[model samples]
Target: MKTQVVIIGAGPAGLLLGQLLYRAGIDNIILERQSGDYVLGRIRAGVLEQVTMDLLHQAGVDTRAHDEGLPHEGIELLFKDARHRIDLHGLTGGKQVTVYGQTEVTRDLMAARAAEGLTTIYTAAPVSLHDFDTAKPTVRYQKDGATHEIACDFIAGCDGYHGISRASVPGDALHLYEKVYPFGWLGVLADVPPVSHELIYANTSRGFALCSMRSEHRSRYYLQVASDQKVENWSDESFWNELRLRLDPEACERLVTGPSLEKSIAPLRSFVAEPMRFGSLFLAGDAAHIVPPTGAKGLNLATADVGFLSRALEIHYREGSQSALDRYSELCLRRVWKAERFSWWFTSLMHRFPENGEFGQKIQEAELDYLVNSRAASTSLAENYVGLPLESF
Candidate 1:
């Protein structure tokens, strides 16, 4: 089979890219190692930056998002047993974030692709990229006890951190930078109303806790735990009890507990691979970088990457120029590093670091005091939180 581009993975990044290119009249095929149900089953962060929402609109898949996604104008920061609100909308010129699950975004993209009769081959395993360094690139995969090869002009590596797209490149050609945090986030999804209308980020003596949601009636909460923490160690009652201890008295009084629909512990890490482009192969989303969920940048960063990639490809096809394609990494890395810094800074400020001891706690408290009181500092936080504007291609 032959197509203009071959996209690996059927996650939001891959699916969104396919939709964008398809709208541009670019022929692309998406290959996924897992079934469609498996992709939607993976629970992820729900906070959507305005830039991500704009990209969904550009891809023409924001109908359900606009109808069901909850928009928040601010977030509360808890410290010293008190809560302070950061006016995200006011501080950032009326910019706001939407609480929409990543799964729902993927589902919307998948539905649009199906309606348009786009090609997405699920359960296409053991995929490999060939000749990406040359003018012609090809992707091969195994399905139904047979090997199929797709010849394409370019390949998109959206298969995530462990997929074959990045692995296909020579190790020496890619420079990897990574920092594994000392703790992980024990997250729970429950069908209960959130304590607060807006999200609350808490930094308490116990640990860091986040009260987020997928919708008005569904809550997603997290607690910082040791890196080696096991999900099975904490029961539903214990999780709720521990969460209440970390919250302010008012929040505790309003908190509602219920059976957890999903529970997992995810380690935090900041990782980036320099030069997102390798000849005709390009990496987007988790394949290119990862940020701790502290700032809710993972999915947003992916959306930005593909937005850049799709524009570059469109320019290549329409104007017959390679300038945008050549500069893809430079443009993406600039924004990626900024987000990485914010995630790292936010994580450091909120989590209890035994290594940092009392000094760290005092410093964090002082910074929180300044961040909530100083307009300049608050504006900076709001600007970054809403997402830095995408650079022009």
Candidate 2:
């Protein structure tokens, strides 16, 4: 089959890109290594920065989100038994974040694609890319035990970090920057009211804990754990007990415990693959960069990456100009690096490193103290958290 573009992976990045392209009258096909059920079943963050919400609206998937998603003007940082709220909206000139799950975003995009009859192949096995460096690119994958080939003008590697998109690039063509933290986040999703109306990020003597929610009745919480920690080792009761210890007294008193619906451990890491474009092939979202979840930048970053990519491709097709297409990598990397810096800094500030010992702990406390007290520091945090303007570099 022949198409204008071939997208690898049906995750948010790939799916969002397909929707954008379809709306622009551009023909594209998506190849997923897993079924639609598997993609929707994966649990992910709910925080939506301003730009992400705008992109969702642009893609015609914001109706449900606007009606049901909770908006928070600020986030609270709990340290030294005190809660300090950073006024994100006030600090960022009226920008705020929405508590809308990534799963919901993907589902909405999928529904739109289905209604429009856009082509997407689920459970496409052994997907591979070829001739990306040439004018004509091709994608091959197995479907129902049969091999199929698709020739396209360009290839979008939106699969993910471990997907073939990044791996297909030769070593000399890609420069990787990465940092894997010594700890991981053990997250639990439960059917209970959240501890607070706004999200709380706590830095306590026990560890780092974040109290977030998917809705009024569904809570998602995370605690810092050893990099090798096993989820099987902690029961629902034990997870709640540990979480309570890290929270302030009021939050502990207000917390409602319930059975966990999902539990998992995710390692913290920041990674960026340079030169997001190679010939006719382009890398977007996690395929090009990954930010630690501390700043809740992963999904938002992906949205921005694909937004830039779609615009670039749109310009190429509509205006017959390759300027935007050629500048895609440079523009995306500029924003990617800023997000990586914020995520790394936020992770380091909130989490306790074993090697840092008491000295590092004291410094972290000092940093948090300064952040909450200084207008400049808090504004910086608020701006980055709500998201820097998509086009601002």
* Candidate closest to the true structure, highest lDDT: 1
Query: Which lDDT tens digits does candidate 1 get at residues 1-393?
Result: 999999999999999999999999899999999999999999999889999999999999999999999999999999999999999999999999999999999999999999999999999998989999998999999999999999999999999999998889899999999999999999999999999999999998889999999988999999999998899999999999999999999999999999999999999999999889999999999999999999999999999999999999999999999999999999999999999999999999999999888888999999999999999999999999988999997
- Model 1 residue 186 lDDT? 98
Give all candidates' CA lDDT scores: 0.96, 0.93
Clashing pairs in 1: none
Q: Given candidate 2, what's the lDDT at residue 70?
A: 99
Clashes of each: 0, 0
Off by over 4 Å in 1: none
- TM-score of structure candidate 1: 0.99
Clashes of 1: 0
Candidate 2 residue lDDT tens string, 266-385: 998899999999999999999889899999999988999899989998999999999999989998989999999999999999998878888888899999999999999999999999
